[model samples]
Target: MALRLKDQLVGQVVDGRYEVLSRIAAGGMATVYLAADARLGRQVALKVMHPHLAADEVFVDRFAREARSAARLSHPGVVGVYDQGAEGGTVYLAMEHVPGRTLRDVLTERGALTAGEALAVVTAMLDALASAHRSDLVHRDVKPENILVGLDGRLRVADFGLARAASASTTAASVLIGTVAYLAPELVTQGRADARADVYAVGVVLFELLTGSLPFTGDVPAQVAYAHV
Candidate 1:
C-alpha cells in the first residue's frame, strides 16, 4: 500500500513554530511534515524526531549538531536546515521546503529511467554529498527516497536526519539505520563510511534506476545484510 501522511501524523505541532499541515514521509527516527512557519509566513519541511529517539540524550545531541552543521552548508543541491529545537516533547528541524517528488516516488511510478536521466540525478546527488563530505558531514543515508527533484529539474538531497558528524561514534546501530538496498558494503562490514561510501550508494542508486531492481534484496533484514556481502 502507498504510504499516506495523514495516517501517520495528525495534530502534531513542532516547537510551536511549525504547524504540521500533513505528513510527508516517515522514517525510523523521525517523521517529516509539510508545515507552515507561523512567524516566517512561508512553508517549511518540519522533521519531528520519534519520541523514542527524542528521549535519548545522545540522539538528541546528534540531531541538533547535524541540523546546525547542515544549516552551515549552502548548496542548491542540499536541503537547507533553518532551525532546530524542542517544544513540549517534540524535537524538530525546520528545513527549506522543496516542492517536488522524491526520486523514489518517480522510480515507483516510471519503473526505470533512461541512462542520461539516471546520470543527471546521480550527479546532482554526488555533488551534494561531496559538499557535505568537504564539511566533515557524512549523510549516513543516501538513497532515492532522500533525493528530491524540484519542478525545475534540480535535484536536492533531503533527510540529513540521519547524518552524523564524521567525528561522531559509528556504532553497529548507526550502520543498520540506513536503507538496506542502498547501503555501502563498507558501512555494513566495518561500521566505517566516508566520501567513498557516498559514491558507493550513488552507484547502487544508479543500478536501481537503470534496472528497476536493487542490486541486493531479501525477505528479511538479515538476508538483506548477507546479500550485501
Candidate 2:
C-alpha cells in the first residue's frame, strides 16, 4: 500500500521545471518529493500542497507568503527557499534539498542527548531563530520536527509555514498555531504570540533534549495546551 502511494507521482513534472523523483515525506499540509530541477539541473525538495488546501485561496496565498518570507532569510542555519508557484491546480514550493534527519528522528531513536550535545544543537537552532527575528519574522512553530540535523554536523531550521512578521498582529482566538507541548503560556491563554513565544518554545525544546520528555503531556491536545497556562 505504501509503495503504491509512493509511486503515484514518481515520474510527474511540476510547473514544467521540477521533475518528481521520489517521495520524501508527507505532513498535514503537503507532501515533499525529491525532484530534479530541469532548468537548473539540480535537485530540490518539492513541497506540493494537498489538493484540498490548494483549493483554498487563503491557504495558497499564505503558503506563497511563507516562501517569500523564508527566502528573504539568508542564513546557514535555515533551509533555503528556491521558488514557489501553482501549475494546473498544484501549488508547490521548491526548496534546497538538505540530506539529513530531523531532530525529532534523533530524539526518537537515541531517547536523549548529553548536556553538551544538547547545548550545541540548541545553539545552532537559536542562531537560525536569531536571523529570522532580525528579519522581523517569528517562527511560531519551533519543535524538533522542524529542525534538520545534517550529516556534516550542521543544523538547519525548516518549515516557516507558521511564521509571521513580528510586527503583524499575531492574535487569533479562532486558531491555535504551534505544537501544544512547546506552546507558551501567552499563546495558550491569549492566543497571542511573538518572538518571545519562540524563545519560550526553545526553552521547552532544551528541556526535552536534556530529559527526553516534554515538560507537559496530556491525553488530549487541549489538556496539554491548558497546562502551558
Candidate 3:
C-alpha cells in the first residue's frame, strides 16, 4: 500500500497519551489512525488534520473547539469524539475507533441496494444526524464517504470536520467545505447551514442508495455547484 506523508506517524505518540499504530484512511481534510491510548489503556481512532491545513491557526482553533463540543454529544449512531489536542502544529482528535467500511465502499462494490436495505442504511445515518440536530449541531457535510458501516453491520455517521452549530453562522466558512455532490443548495448560495441542510444531504444520500447515482452530474465542480444553486 502506498503511504501518504501524513501517515508517517505509524509508531509515534501524540500528546503523550495516544500511540499511533497504523493508518486507517485519509480524507480531503484529515487522516485517521488506529492508536492505543496509553492513559486510558484503550484503543482510539486518532484523526489528525493534514499538516498543510493544520498550519492555519484559525482553522486549527476552530477544529479543536468544535471537536471538543462534539465530544459532549452522546449517541450510539454518532461516532463518539473522545479528546482533542494539538501538539506542536499537528492538531488531532481522539475518537471512538470503529472497524468498518464506508458507505462509499459498499456502493462501489455493490451497486444499488434494495429499498429495504437502503432504508436501513439511511435510517441509521438520519438517526445520528437527528441527534446532532437536537444538540444544535449541523453536520454540514454528509455523504456516503462520511457514513460508516461497521464490521458487525451497524451503521454510524462519522466526520464532523465541517459541522457547525445552528447559531454559529455569524461568519461564513473560509473555504467551500463538503463534497460538492452532496452539498445543499443554500449552503452554496448563502453560506449558511442548519438542521435542514443536513436533512437535504440525508435526502441526497438516500437517493444515491436507491438509484446508485448522484442527483446532479457535471464534468467540473463549478458545474455541480451551479446545478446546486
Candidate 4:
C-alpha cells in the first residue's frame, strides 16, 4: 500500500495513468483526488475506494458495477464516469473533473440561497435524477455535498449509484447508512429505497438549502432515526 498523505495526494500515480495532484474531497467510502491523466493529457477526478472498503469483496464488486452503470449516463447535470480499474490493490474511478464549489460549500458560505438559485440547483438535480431513474439507476445518496455547482452556474450530481451499490448486499438489519439528517423516512424505517426515496431526499436537500438547516437534528443515530418519524 502507498503511504497516505495527510493534506494532499501528490506524487502518486493511480493505475499508471492518473497522477495525483491534490486531494479534492473525502467521503465515507472513497477519497477523491484531482489528478492529471497522463495518457489523455487531461484533468480528471479520481475516486479511490478507501482501504477499509477495498477489503470487502461485496463493496468492490458493487463499486465496479456502479461505475459501469454511471458511465452509461450522460447529461449536462450528471458528472460522467470515464473509466474504472484496480491497480496495486487500489480501486480507482476516473470521472469528469468538475471545476466549481460544492453545493454544501456554497450553502455554508452563503448561509441560505435565494429562491431562484435554490430552484435552479434543485431543477438540475432533479433533471439528473430523472435521467438516472429512466435508466433504472437509483442514486441513493442525494445531498448538498454531492451536488456540485460548476463555474458556469450549472449544477451537476456526483457519486451516482455509489452509496446504494455499496450497501446493497450488506445486511441492513442493524446498520443505518447514509447521511442522517438527509435520509428518507422510508429508508430509515423500512429499509426500502426506490426512486420515491430519492425524491424524498431531494425534498430534504431543498428544505435545507432554503432554511439553512436540516429539518431534523439529533445527537445519535437512533435519535436521528426517531426524528425521521
Candidate 5:
C-alpha cells in the first residue's frame, strides 16, 4: 500500500531479524505484513502498530496486552505469537502466519452458510475463546474478520490485541473496544466486558453466517449501535 512507503519496513529488515515482505492487511491500530524470519527461515505474520498508535503513549498498554495475550496461547484453534518489540517508530508483534480466507470472506462468497456449516465455523471459534477465557483473557473484538478459516481447513480465532487481559471486566475511557454491531448491551452501557460478552459476539457471528447480514441496520453508526443496545 501507499502507506508502506511511510513505513520503512517492507523490503527492509527489522530488529536485525524479520524481513518484512509485503503488506497483508491494515486495521485501526496496526498494519499486518507477511514477513520472513531470517534466523528461523520461516514465514510469520508481522503486526506493526500504526505510526500514530506506536508513537502515542495512550495505546502502549493495549498494544502490550495483545502481544502478551497471543503469546500465551498455544491452542490449535488460535494463532500463536512468537515475539514482540519496538524499533524506532515501529512497534511490531510477530505471530503465526496462516494461509486462508476469513469468515467474512466465506459469507461474502457463499452468500450464507447452512446450519451445519455455520455451526462448524462457530464451534471452532468458541473453542478458541474458551481457551482465552480459561487463561484470564477476554477478547474485546470477536468479529468475523478476526476469525481466519485457513486454506488447510483449520479455523483460527485471532486478534487478541484489544482485551481485558485481567480476569475482571474493565472500564475504559473509550466508548467501546469492539465492533459496535457485535457489542453486548452491557459493553455499550458500561464499557465493561467479560467472557459472556465474547460468547454474545460469537453468537452474533453465527447469526450473520446464517443470514449473510447483520441483525441491525442503520443509516449511521449511532443508529446501528442503538439497535445493538
Candidate 6:
C-alpha cells in the first residue's frame, strides 16, 4: 500500500495560542482539527481556512462573519465560538469541540431513526435556529452535516459560515450558499433566505431522519437544486 501523508498542521501552533492536535475532518472550505488552547488549557475545534481560500478577500470576510455571527448568539443548542485569528496565512476559528459524530454519520450508520429520536433531533435544531433568527441572523445552510451530536446525547447546530444577517438580500445570481437537497425553493430560485429557509431545510432533514433518504435526488447537484425550485 502507498504510504499516507501526514497533515502539516497537526503539530503546529496557530497564532501562538491553539496547538493543533489532529485533524477531525476536511470540508470544501476548511479543515477542522482537535486543538489545545494553551491560555485556557482546554480543547477546541479549530476550523482553519484553506490557504487558497484565505487569499480571497470574499472568503476571508465570510470566515470573519462566521466568528462574528456565532459569537453574537448564546444558545446551548448552538456551538460556541471561542476565538478567531490569523497567523501568517492561516485563518481559523476556535470553537467548542463537540465530541461525537454528525447527524449525517448517524443516518449513514443507522439508516433511519425512530419517531422519538427524530423528534428530539429536529427539536434541538429548531431551537438552535430560533436563537439565530431572534438575533437577526439567517443560518442560510442547514443540513445533517452541520448538526453535531454530542456523546452525551446533546444535539448542536454548527457551521455558521454560510449565515448572514436577515436584512441582507441575496440573489440567485450570487454564488450558491447551501446544500442542494436541503435548499429552500426561494433560495434556489431567487437566492433569498431568511428564517423560513432554515425551517424548510430542517423539515427536509427531519424527513431524511425518519425516512433514511432525501426526498429528492438527481445525477447532478443542479438537478437537485432545480427540484427545490
Best by lDDT: 4
Whole-model alpha-carbon lDDT for candidate 3: 0.79
* CA error at residue 228 for candidate 3, angstroms: 1.7
- lDDT (0 to 1) per candidate: 0.77, 0.80, 0.79, 0.81, 0.78, 0.80
lDDT of 5 by residue, 157-206 (tens): 88775544221213332324336788777776776768898999998999
TM-scores, in order shown?
Answer: 0.88, 0.89, 0.91, 0.91, 0.89, 0.90
lDDT of 4 by residue, 1-229 (tens): 2336424357778777899998888776678888999999999999887776676678778888988999999898999999998976688899999999899999889987888878878888898999999999988778888998899888899988787766764543222344777777877777668898788889988898888998888777778766987
| Backbone clashes, candidate 6 | 0
Off by over 4 Å in 3: 1-7, 161-178
Per-residue alpha-carbon lDDT of candidate 1 for residues 1-229, written as tens digits (9 for 90 to 100): 1144345455655666777788777776567889999999999988776666666767677777778888898899999989999876677888999988999899999999999988888888888989888998778778888898899889999866465532242342543545777667777787677778788888999999999999887877767765776
Whole-model lDDT for model 1 versus the true structure? Answer: 0.77
Residue pairs with clashing backbones, model 5: none
RMSD of 5: 3.3
lDDT of 2 by residue, 9-109 (tens): 68988888889999988765568899999999999998876666676676667767877988898999998999999997788888889998999999999
Candidate 6 residue spans exceeding 4 A from truth? 1-6, 163-178
Q: Which has the better lDDT: candidate 1, or candidate 5?
A: 5
lDDT by residue for model 3 over 83-107, one digit each (tens)?
9888997778898998989999999
Q: Would you give me the overall lDDT of model 5?
A: 0.78
lDDT, candidate 3, residue 182?
81
Ranking by lDDT: 4, 2, 6, 3, 5, 1
Which scores higher on TM-score, 4 or 6? 4
Candidate 6 vs. truth: CA RMSD? 3.8
